[model samples]
Target: MKKLVKLMVFIIALYIFLEINNQWLVVTEHVLESEKIPSSFNNYRITQVTDLHDATFGDNQQKLIEKVRATNPDAIFITGDLIDSNRYDLENSLHAVEAFVKIADVYYVLGNHEVAINKMDEIYIALIELGVHVLPNESLVLERDGERLAIVGIEDPLMGMETEEMLNIALANVPDDMFTLLLSHRPERFDTYVAKDVDLVFSGHAHGGQVRLPFIGGLVAPGQGMFPKYTAGTFTENDTTMVVSRGLGNSIVPYRLFNLPEIVVMELKSK
Candidate 1:
């Protein structure tokens, strides 16, 4: 009887640990430096919130908002998967964005989930109403101290258009030499972003491979399949650098193991 009792206690403890890992939020920071970064924009902070899947962190998303506010980001980038297609909860997801807009300029792009929901119009309208810059195959310029930095966003390829074609149209007007930042949903397209000479890219979708392994890295990802690359962290090739967020919420998997929810806080520096 004592042995059985001890076994039950161990099982309960393990369950609690896993639950905390999934529910708790953690912040990860990275500093990126490049000569292309305009001097005026040095020390520019960008807080990335991705793949939320409509998960809540505290009442009205206060906990999540506070985390971003503490970072003092000049801009908040909502890479994609803000709402899970499975759950399709726009109002719940927007709770975070509403607060984010008041903190800093909010930029967003579509994810596979948004495409699957087929309610893109409704989602776009709602975010735009809340002062969020919904960039769907669009480009805009951020000018400070007489210097220019282009921000380009593309829709997920799941939206019927090829990713490459969408990128071409988006960059048609932007100069080749200008410092450009691309907000994309799929990280598997790193090669395409590099080929286009994009200076930086922010992406999310893997959900940190859903389950991370000890040294083998992420167990699986959406595009890359088993042990997929670009699950999280920064990747650089040529002049292009992509930061992949593990993301904050889950989708079909329904649970996370070892992989805690993460918010990537990136600070840009001019070399």
Candidate 2:
């Protein structure tokens, strides 16, 4: 009987600890090197913000912006789910969005929440006005020195069209000699991006499986069931590298256990 009581107390303590840890924000840094990188863009930093879900770290997301500003990023990439669908509040998210725009060039892709909330048109229009490169099956070119790189964004599959079809359109105009960066919401479609010969891809939506178990990785994710692959970290296939952020917010899972919010920073290095 005493052992049973002690076990119960331990479980309760563990739950409390996990809840507190989930609120803590963290920054993850990585360096991506490739011969394809241009010298002019060497050491170029990119801050990735994903799955905000209307969660504010501080007033108007001032704390979050401060963290990003310290990175001195050349650009900010928002992979998706900037707002929550069930809550359906844009004003809160827009404040963070507005702050992000002031930092650097921002590129965004659509997430499932954006479509589920049914505010796609309104959100896209507002973002476009902010000079954000909100790509929906589209591509944009950034030039450094005499070299150019392609940054493409794909819409979420919930938008009523096949993702592969949209991918074809986005990559159609990319030049053969340029380095390509694809912004996709789902990491599960990594093979599709690899098949297209994309140089690198940034993705979120798995939320690090919401509850990671050390070496076991994420417990479950939306699209990928139990023990889903590609939950976080860098994965390679052929010539493409996919960096999946654990993400900054949660949706299906009420609280993340062992999975904390993180902002991923990538520095491009020339090999």
Candidate 3:
């Protein structure tokens, strides 16, 4: 019995040690094939970074910026949670977004934190000044080679508004023939996007369950309870595909186990 107890303690200690250390920020590349993808836009690269929560990577997010620059994406998408309301760092978050603005066409949507903290107005104004396109429950047309695509961004559902109606109105402008992309904060609400017939969705709020195990996936997420189904990776339903990022920063629990920070690079193909 004593030996078993000692082994358990050792395992626990090792787990904690691993959680605090070795948080390597790795890039996960995904290739998505779609018939709707424009011929001129084939092989278009999109870099997604989410759940920053005011965490700094190197001096003033230099390391993160360098990695993004290396990717040379056609556009950068920030799903949500640029700053944590509970532990706010305005400068770091704004600076990071500012740096990103210079790199690519930055498009963003709010996560729960942005609403909870009541900084959406201020941050939205700031982002606009930096040339970052902040899409709020609307679709924006992206054109290349005379072919057009639609990207829709929605406000997080934490604001106690009618989601189904709001989404219907937001997506009303997108034509049936055009390829569509959605920037939603919550991955758990993927069903909503699928129901709306959106082609692709990008989200980050689960934080990769805050801690993950190999094969087991994520442990727990905010909206989804223990062993949440939509914690990480890609989920496809019908014609819609949802890409959930493990996220680039931490919140609430303040640590990640086996789940390292990541920047998701999605390569869109005209298959």
- Candidate topping TM-score: 1
Whichever of 1 and 3 has more lDDT, that candidate is 1
Per residue, candidate 1 scores C-alpha lDDT tens digits across 174-258 of 9988899899999999999999999999999999988888888798999899989999999999999999999999999888888
- State in Å the error of residue 138, model 2: 0.6
Ten consecutive residues with minimal summed lDDT in candidate 1?
Answer: 17-26
Q: Pick by lDDT: which candidate is best?
A: 1
Please give the ranking of all candidate structures by TM-score, highest first, separated by commas.
1, 2, 3
Better of 1 and 3 by TM-score: 1
Error in Å for residue 210 of model 3? 1.0
Estimate, for each residue in 197-256, the C-alpha lDDT of model 3 and write its tens digit: 889999999999887888889999998999999877899999999999999888777778
For model 2, give the 10-residue run with minimal summed lDDT: 18-27
Pairs in clash, predicted candidate 1: none
List the candidate 3 regions with Cα displacement exceeding 4 Å: 1-23
How far in Å is the alpha carbon of 261 misplaced in model 3?
Answer: 0.5
What TM-score does each of the candidates earn? 0.97, 0.93, 0.92
- Which lDDT tens digits does candidate 2 get at residues 38-157? 888889898999998887778888878888888888999999999999887788888877878898999999799999988899989988898889999999999978878889999999
Comparison by lDDT, 1 against 2, better one: 1
Instruction: TM-score winner between 1 and 2, please give it.
Output: 1
Reference-based lDDT, each prediction: 0.92, 0.88, 0.88
